[model samples]
Target: MKNIKVKTLGAVLAVLAIANSHANETAEEQGEGMLFRSLFGDTLERTYGITVSGLLDIGFSRNNRSTSDERDDGLSNLPITGLSDEGLELGSLHLFVDKPLKANAIPRVTPLPGPKPETADFGFTIEALYGRNAQFSRTYGWDMGWDMNEEDNAKAKRDRLSFMSVPNLAATAYLPYGPGFTIMAGVFGPIIGYEIPPNIRLAPNPFASRTYAFVSNLTTVSGVLVGTRIMDGPHGLLGIELGIAQGWSNMRDNNDDKALLGALRWRTPDMNTWIDYEFMVGNQENESTRDIQAPTSRLISADGQLRQQHSLNGWHRFSEHWLLGMELVYGHQDGDGKPTTVDIVTGPGFDGAHWWGANAVVTYQIRPDLSFSVRGEHFSDPDGFTLFPTTTARGDFNAITAGFRYDLNHNVSIRPELRYDWFDAIEHDRPFGNGRDRTQLTATVQALVYF
Candidate 1:
């Protein structure tokens, strides 16, 4: 896998050069005004800080079908035929660390104790994620008339190796009474060094299977989250927040299933806003009644499931240059034994399907180290067709992306990107026969660092 992603990116740049050489010898014996008041802090001992981040991505692409068939049954079945060339690519590598513990560093130049009230803090976040191509079946494509082949569909090839570690410990308690309130809690876990393929949406072509030992077996996911907030001043200067989460999967086989998530946010001092929701229930494997041809339907058994997801996002800055954003997502699935017809012609049986999407973005700084951006997205197909008829139908698809950014300082950053995709489907089966469409172009470059 590209020499194990270049020896895990040279061991994360040798641990970020030993944490920037111990933060530059602790900022030359704490000069620079007590090292910027101990990494940014001052009024009455409010001290807490830590940050380390990473991202590196590279890309190129062009397509139309048959590089041995890359599936996309709708949006006009287009799989860019046989190896159209481009070059070097690897994306998704993230490393994170963030810390803070109760803060309050003087300011108020004389507002008496009138406002200095809101308090409560605790924090932790540690993360590592690596991705190459990172599935979605190389951006959708797959079907091969069932009996799945190509080495069991090369587990949707996107060049593999998957590892993710997530740890977060949190706390927030500020509301010694009044307007600026707070109450938050946390717990997180997502340790998976390998074994991924619990059906990343039945890969037909999810970015060509991207590593993780070509999917499945080796798993761990643990969780707990809680939250509450209402701040506007007394240190927070802004307000609104809410959160919830519960999770478990193979945490020693507690019936092997569970999940739920919720979120909401709004902040101001500068600007911030947000919203989120999620739900999931699990158990899988049925592959259209295991292709029922009898023989006890090839020894039937394995297909217990229920899944759901909903998402919405928004961010606006309106100044300090400009920024605006939006996103919406919906999903669903339900399955449990008996209910065939190859599961309603492959839309996956007993009725229930949904998909809705929307996204828009605009950002501009032009200075402060340059910046620019644009984004768009649309997708639909929560069952408007395709429950078999030789499979492949569920909303035509549309996509667009653009970018530019540079900030070699204040942490670090670099970005260059372009993307375009299109698909449509009504019917013409034979792996999406006649009714097909194509259009693809991709280019990417990214680098980010923060500490």
Candidate 2:
């Protein structure tokens, strides 16, 4: 807790320093800064030039189940469970720095006669982030049929207050094609998480002689991203970005991942409606098997396991005060070829499934700086992907959320939101006991200040 407070104070100080630097710049310098300011908006203008920005997101909610169940298991088949009663979760605190190729250097005004133009725009950026959340569990209590004693429960509760920090660093190069088009390429180092590595082996016998053990394994990732934007005419605009990364740990053999995304904005003379689509694909090697008899059992291979998602959203403005929007999302995961494990066991073929959902939202502008919105979403699993061994039937879930946002100033905004979620069943037979359904009420107060 003390460490978090200190980090929060550092972030606040960074913001103030950036503001002071911009205030002291001369008019000519400000005019040159306007180009970047207009391109990245207010948020990027303040932080992109400096090297640090901080964010704090604290939320509270009430749930019928324990908080531990809310953790995302990375398995789409797992039945979603557990929620918090009331607590604070830090969303992110980001510190980034940009390094330009030329420092305080002036470009030549006149080009060589009959010579092709030569210009170079290259830079690099490094970023660090901190995020926190509460973990909870449901099986340790007497109500869940567990025979655990009081001491075990207390130990588990103590473990739930842990936090995680992630640091990311990347380098970028900008290539200009003309007045309004440029291609950007970047490579980022691993996003190191301050927790136990995801995949590791724990031997059963302590004194057993080890013939083959891979000890130098570490959790790391590397990725490349490219983005392009065109501002040709006044009628519309187009933008696209793609990224690919490879995992450096032993979770899978020959493991490499990929992601692709694109967006387009179009507006008529009146500028009333717009549409967007986003997609992502990731592949990871599944659980591995080793033979005890063969010293050469550590063979490298690809498991052909992957997860894919796609989302499309559209919005239309009827007037200055009202807007309507709809969104569709689909996701699928193909478990490894090995027969899925019940408790650290593996066997053959695809063992998982897919799910999809649709949602709609309505927004009303109550004032120039305030807006109210309501949203509804429904989700279901198809092909009956199983997470827990007790059941094979996947149920449906739905949620409704309403919220309002108040802009305190141009760079800061506050949002208060309320949400209700319902699940069809805990499993197939455990449908929330009686007709009374599984429900959760969540309230969140978020403050956002950019740059």
Candidate 3:
């Protein structure tokens, strides 16, 4: 408790300091300083060239089916984190500061964010969140005081629906060689999918409700990553990114195992179409898993087996009013299957686990401030590894969602969505409605107030 208090206090003080970082400068000298004064009053971006933004998301959701039992509430949206519940709750209070490193050597068709380009050689980004969405993104070794432990559970915080989490914090350095190299070190965003992490980005959420595929994808990592633009001519823009990290979501390396991560990207010169292939290969097992693994457990010894994930995602701007995007993900983990959220690790069963999923989305812009989107996805967790790690829950979940985004203004937007889910159970009789029903229907509406 003391540690959490200290961390909270420190964060508050840091934000206060950064808020007043350039207060000494006059509003006249900074054009944006005057513009934003009516809003946030000279934020870091206006004076010191640091981008600061925040979001408050509040919403309500209704699930047509749910369990009456308290052990697990089907309305809580098990196996789903972002919209993981069926009631009106404070989704998240998000804040972030970003100083982007400019790709000085060449200009690209795609747009980057910032008031103006800073030709400086170094930059950094730090993002944090407090609310119901923190449970899944919190890293094992990294979330220290912010994580849900015995004490938190005692308070009946079992939904894992409320807390504080830091998803990404890293410093970037630009090199002058070739098209220019961008080197970054620290915790980095999820690289295995097209959807931006809820905690990593402040605005322009792809959709109010997360897809089945994305929820089962990967999360953050503590590591060092490098990237460079290899092509900037008329043919198009091409780039490559590579990195090394403490396996999966591990914030601090718990063993000798490490993961290799990278991506290959290409985009049309017109910026109308793009695609990327991403991959992460390494061992994943925290101390808890190691302590309770069976004699045959791969991670029990130094020779931990590799956990591999691959993602292929792309999108095309079909026209001024139309766009389409898609993603496919496949991964597997090798283990003795004795792990279940550390400390309480128990039985041993399967030798390996595999999961795969695919999704596609289409969006139409009826106007600038209002748009409509529809998505359909199918995800399978036959081995029960990714979706239900603590129990023998194995199945395939298929869902379709349709939603609309209406921006009342530049700072606030409302999103209403309808989603339908059906399950093909492999281990249990059903996946929803207390494991008695195979289908679940839900409706949700959320509003994002940005500052």
Candidate 4:
């Protein structure tokens, strides 16, 4: 009887070992997954063959200006961006997915036969951001719905210092006919400037802070842009794009009239040098105050803000480790407005406003993972308009930025920047140091990690 009990125990142990082996085999067949995938869903890339990327940015900055300079509740110190009075905060966060395109070769797979003369390809980008930088990135209509009315999380309240914005959600289609034309629809960043936006990972800009000239850029546009290559050869490839948008930086139309925008681009076949001339023109102003009864001057003035801009920018890589880039912008708004902030001047002038600016940058690549960059910019806004929306006291805004880009690895980078801003041509009031000082100096260090 004891021998029979021992045999039974041995048989049970062998059966349990076989069951464990089968369980291991099943787990292997299911593919590798994160330890927490059982709780949270699997990653899109691992489950659906899609590509995903994300970035987290944080920084701390100290400006010469005092905390007394802050305005509008708990956020924003004029002329000082990226590193506002609220330092040591999340600067920007981005998570996106994209499939980029090749303009000329996307249609190469199409056969030349009578019936098979059509092959096509497409791509898309969906990007979103959250942090203090969203203040400058909000697209009207979409984000405006929440931001305009000063909803719960719209403004940078004292309790909540961060906000969110969707800068891009666009798609592109490449056609097979006639050297391959492309059509892009939805919201995208303005195609005029060399500087970067809150979407830092998508751009090669080396600066962590913004230049005064950046105020002239229109931020985002919602509409359709169509393009086709005009020339292709050893000299270069020239292309032209034409678009009609609701207006500058707006996902929803501000007026019934539409804005016309277009660009002409030229570059070397090797892409060593590139140049672009871009323009936008249309009426851009609020129409919510339109008086249906008698024609109010306020309504007429709001409709009269016909806005236009022209931008020319280019870059050339002169050497393996050195490059230079420049951008010039001009803008005009044909309407009347008033200054909300006043210091010394009794009467502010706002008959018409025309603004212009220029930016120049030099970069030296010190190593595969490090670079040094310097940029100088000057912008003039005689009567406000694009410089400061609520104030007609804008002036000749000048700034210089010096910074370094150091990458610790493929997914991590750090930037330390020093910036100085001064108003050479004072309009009505001083903008820094609680309306006391003429210049502002800021220093910042930031880190970025990617996933």
Better of 1 and 2 by TM-score: 2
Q: How does model 2 score by TM-score?
A: 0.58
TM-score of 3: 0.81
What's the number of clashes in each of the models? 53, 4, 2, 0
Instruction: Give residue 76's lDDT in candidate 1 (0 to 100).
Output: 21
Task: Give per-residue CA lDDT, model 4, range 219-284, as digits (tens).
Answer: 788998877676777777677778888887776664577888888887787777878888888876
TM-score of each: 0.26, 0.58, 0.81, 0.78
Candidate 3 lowest-lDDT run of ten: 105-114
Q: Would you list the rank order by lDDT, best first? A: 3, 4, 2, 1
Task: Give one digit per residue, the lDDT tens place, for model 3 in 359-404.
Answer: 9989998998788999998988886666543123577878888999
Residue range 1-451, candidate 1, lDDT tens digits: 4687688768757644544554565643321123233444554233445654444433344334323233221112222211112333344444545453333211100011234345654555544444432222110011112232222213334333332323233343444344434444544332111112221111111122112111111122334433334344535332223333332222222223345443444334443443333333343223344243211111122444454445545556677888676656555555443444134344323444555566566778678677677766565554632122212445555566677777554433556666565656444322322344344554545444444
Better of 1 and 3 by lDDT: 3
Cα lDDT tens digits for candidate 2, 113-174: 12122364566655444333211111111111223222333343333333332323455554
**Model 3 misplaced regions, further than 4 Å:** 1-40, 67-75, 104-120, 146-161, 199-205, 287-302, 336-346, 389-392
lDDT of 4 at 348: 35
Question: Which candidate do you rate higher for TM-score, 1 or 4?
Answer: 4
**Deviation from native of the Cα of residue 419 in model 1, angstroms:** 25
Global lDDT of each candidate: 0.38, 0.40, 0.65, 0.64
- The better candidate by lDDT, 1 or 4, is 4
